[model samples]
Target: MTQLIFINLPVADLNRSIAFYEAVGATKNPMFSDDTAACMVLSDVIHVMLLTHDKWRTFTDRAIPDAHASAQMLLCLSRDSRDAVDAVVAQAGAAGGTADPNKPQDYGFMYGRSYADPDGHIWETMWMDPAAVAAGPEAFAAHELTPV
Candidate 1:
C-alpha cells in the first residue's frame, strides 16, 4: 500500500472545524469520522484527523496547547501556481479563518501565503516552479530567478 500521512489536530468545535477544512479544499471522509472526530482528506496520500479535546485525551495525556497564543508546528501545502496559493488562502479567510497570519513570500521562482484556522492552526500554501525545483537548491544559490 502507498504510504500516507494523517495529521491529527485537536479542535474546539467539531462541526465548525469540518466546515473550515472543507472550505480549504479538503473533503470529509465519513468512513473514518464520528461525532468526536473527523477525517478530512487533502489528497490521496494526505489526511487530516480533527479530534475533540475529550477524544484527543484518549490518544495521549498531553495538555492541549492554545494554538492561538503558542506556535505548534507550521503546516504547508503546495499549489500549482501563485494564484492557487492565493486562492486557497482567500478561501480560508472567507470561510472564517484568518488570512495572511504571516507575510506573504515572493522569491520570483516561488510564492507562499498562510492562514490560521479558527482553532489557530496555521497552514501555508506555496507554489514553486517545477523546473526550478528539479534544478535543485544549488542552482538557485548560484543566481536569483529573473523577474518574469
Candidate 2:
C-alpha cells in the first residue's frame, strides 16, 4: 500500500479553521471528522487534520506552540504554475487569512507565496518548472547562497 501523509494541527476554533481550510480548497472528509476534529483532504495522498486544543492534547503531552509567536512548521503545497500559486494565496487572503507575511519569492524558474490562516498556521504555495529543476543544482546554487 502507498504511504499517505496526514498533517495534524492544533486549532483554537474548530469551525473557523474548517471554514478557512475549505476556503483554501480542501474538502472535509466526514469519515474522519467530528465536533473536535476535522479531516481536510488536500489531495488523495495528503490530508490535514485540524484538531481542537482538547483533541490535540490527547495526541501528545508537549505543549502546542503559539503559531503567531513561533513557527512550528511551514506547510507547503505545489501548484501547476506560477499563476496557480498566486491565485491560491489570493484566495487565502480573501478568506480572512494574511497573505505573504514574508516577501513572495521568485527565482525565475520557481515562485512561491505564503499565507497565515486564522490560527496563524503558515501555508506556502509554490510552483517550479520541471524542466528548470531538471537543469540541476547550478540553477538554484546562486539563490541558495544569497542571503535573503
Candidate 3:
C-alpha cells in the first residue's frame, strides 16, 4: 500500500472545528469520525483528525503546544488556481477564521496566502506551477522565502 498521512490535531471544541472545516469545503470521513474526533478529508491520501484535547492526550505523553502561544504544526493546502486559494481564504474568514492580512506573493512560479483556524492553527493556501518551480530557486527569485 502507498503511504498515507493522518495528521491528528487537538482542539478545544470538536463541533466548532468541524463546522469551520466544512465551511472551508472539507468533507468528513465517516469511517474515522466520531464524537471525540472528526476526520477531515483533505485529499485521498491526507486525512486530518480533529481530536478533543482529552482524546488526543491519550495518544502521546508530550505536552500539546498551546496553538496561540507556540507552533505545534502548520497545515498547507495547495489549490489548482490562484482564485481558488483566495476563495478558500475568504470562506475561512467568513466562517469565523481569520486570514493573515499580508500582501500576496508573486514568485513567478508560485503564490501563497495564509490563514488561521478558529483555534489559532496556521494554515497556508498556495498555488504553484511545477514547470516554473523546476527552474531552481534563482529562476524565480534570488532567495528562498518562508512565511513569517
Candidate 4:
C-alpha cells in the first residue's frame, strides 16, 4: 500500500491560503474542502490540509505559533531538475509568496530554494542528480563534486 502524507496547517485565512497553495501547484480536492478547511493535493502522495484557527483547535490544544516570526517546520518537495526548483520558486514569488526566504543551497549534485506562503509557512523545493542520489549520501562526502 502506498502511504500518503497529510500536512495540516492552521491558517489565518482559509480562502487566502487555499489560493496560495493553488498558485504554487496544488489543486484543491473539492471532495475534502469546505468552509472550515481545504485539502490541497500537491502530488499523489502529498496533501496539505489548510484549516482555520477555529477548526485547528478541534485537533490540537497547543497554541498556533506565528509562522512569520517562528518556524515549527519547513515543508519540502522534490523537483526533477535544478531548473525545475527555480521555476517553482519563481511561481511562488509571482503568486505573492515571499521567494527565497531561506538561503538557496548548491552542492553540485544537489540544489534547493525556498518560499514562504502568505501565512508565513516556508516551503522548500529541491533537486538532486539521479546519479548522486543512487550513489547515496556518503558518495557526496567522499567525492568532490563541485560545480564547474
- What tens digits encode model 1's per-residue C-alpha lDDT throughout 1-148? 9999999999999999999999999999999999999999999999999999999999998899999999889999999999899899999999999999988888777888899999999998899889889999875796564432
**lDDT, residue 78, candidate 4:** 94
Model 4 poorest ten-residue lDDT run: 139-148
Tell me model 4's lDDT, rounded to 2 decimals: 0.91
As a whole number from 0 to 100, the lDDT of residue 1 in candidate 1 is 100
Q: Relative to the true structure, how large is the alpha-carbon lDDT of every model? A: 0.93, 0.91, 0.83, 0.91
* RMSD of candidate 3 to true structure, Å: 2.5
Rank the candidate models, highest lDDT first.
1, 4, 2, 3
- In model 4, which residue pairs have backbone atoms overlapping below 3 Å? none
In model 2, the worst 10-residue window by lDDT is 139-148
Of the pair 3 and 4, which is ahead by lDDT?
Answer: 4
Candidate 3 residue spans exceeding 4 A from truth? 101-104, 134-138, 141-148
Compute each candidate's TM-score over C-alphas.
0.94, 0.93, 0.86, 0.93
Tell how far residue 96 is off in model 4, in angstroms: 1.4
lDDT of 3 by residue, 57-105 (tens): 9999888787777776667878998889899999989988888644566
Q: Which stretches of candidate 1 lie above 4 Å from their native place?
A: 143-148
Superposed by TM-score, candidate 4 places the C-alpha of residue 77 at a distance from the truth, in angstroms, of 1.0
* Model 2 lDDT at residue 63: 96
Ranked candidates (TM-score, high to low): 1, 2, 4, 3
